[model samples]
Target: MEKKQRMSRRSEQMGDQIEERIVTGVYPPGMRLDETELASGFGVSRTPVREALIQLASAGLVEIRPRRGAIVAEIGQHRLYEMFEVMAELEAMCGRLAARRITESEQRALVAAHQACEAARDANDPDAYYQRNERFHHLIYAASHNVFLEEQAAALHRRLRPYRRLQLRVRDRMGTSFSEHAGIVEAILAQDGELAATRIRTHVVVQGQRFADLIASLPMLGSPSLT
Candidate 1:
């Protein structure tokens, strides 16, 4: 059982790495993902690579075909916009509920997560900030005390992870993101549900110039890849 669990975890980690590469244009859309190559790159067996590919396929990041093996899927910009719109609303709901329901312990944890994000931002490390940022948002979701809502939010959050990480790579985005997180933390701590909701919505929703920036940063479909 322990060995099986370890394999599962390895597969999940492999899937995450593959997802990151795809989102960052290292593995562009429609690029063939050979299991043996992936396994060799990660220094793992083909079994975990295959399992990871399956997981990515389920997430719509990779498509599995009879003869084509696993290929990266081309996610349309419009569809991404739609997903972000829904994500904004879901995060807003989580923020609102968290403000009303958060306990002292959860609040402390949330603050700690924010502080970690601050450290990452100060260091000018987008990758570090991205990981800490995820923790900060997750703490709020847990503080909401709504299991169903938390589950839904987490699911969408996972699907949008690649885009969110990419967004963080934009110039000065890490600092801006950390600043927005400060406002969110303040509202939740103040127990101002409406303000928390509004702040979180604004933080998550890409609009106007922000949307344009994200679209411009996206890797072009069918781009050449060395992988």
Candidate 2:
């Protein structure tokens, strides 16, 4: 059981790494993902690599064809926008519920996550900030005290992870994001459900200049390569 659990955790980590590479254009859209190569690259057995690819497929970040094996999935801008739209609403709901239902311990945890994000921002490290930012948002989801809603929010969060990380690379976005997070944390901690919902929704929804910036920064799609 312990060995199985360890493999599962490794596969999850592999999935996250592969998804990052895909989003960052290391594994461009349409690139064939060879299990053996990936296994070697990640220093694992083919079993975990296959498992990772399968998980990515389930998240719609990878497509597994009958004979073609696995290939990176290309998400068009419009489709991505739609996904973010839904994500914003889902997160808003979480914020609203969290404000109403969060326990004292959860509130402390949320603050800690926010502080971690602040450290990452102060250091001007987008990669570190991105990871901490995920934890911050996830704490809100868990604090909502709704298992089903938490599950839905988490699933969509995974699907949008790459784009969200890319957005952080925009100039001064880390500072802006941290400021927005400040508002969100304040409202939630104050137990203001409506205010928390509004703040979180505004923070999440990419609009106008932000949308343009994200699209402009997207890694250029290229021909598939078996890397």
> How far is 159's C-alpha from truth in model 2 (Å)?
0.7
In TM-score terms, candidate 1 sits at 0.91
Candidate 1 structure lDDT: 0.89
Off by over 4 Å in 2: 220-227
lDDT of 2 by residue, 106-208 (tens): 9999999999999999999999999999999999999999999999999999888878998999999999999999999999999999999999999998988
Question: In angstroms, how far off is 12's CA in candidate 1?
Answer: 3.4
Q: How close is candidate 2 to the true structure, as a TM-score?
A: 0.90
What value does the lDDT take at residue 59 in candidate 1? Answer: 74
Tens-digit lDDT string for candidate 1 (94-207): 999999999999999999999999999999888899999999999999999999999999889988887898899888889899999999999999999999999999999998
Q: What is the lDDT of residue 203 in candidate 1?
A: 98
Per-structure clash totals for the candidates:
0, 0
What do the candidate models score in CA lDDT, each in turn?
Answer: 0.89, 0.91
Off by over 4 Å in 1: 220-227
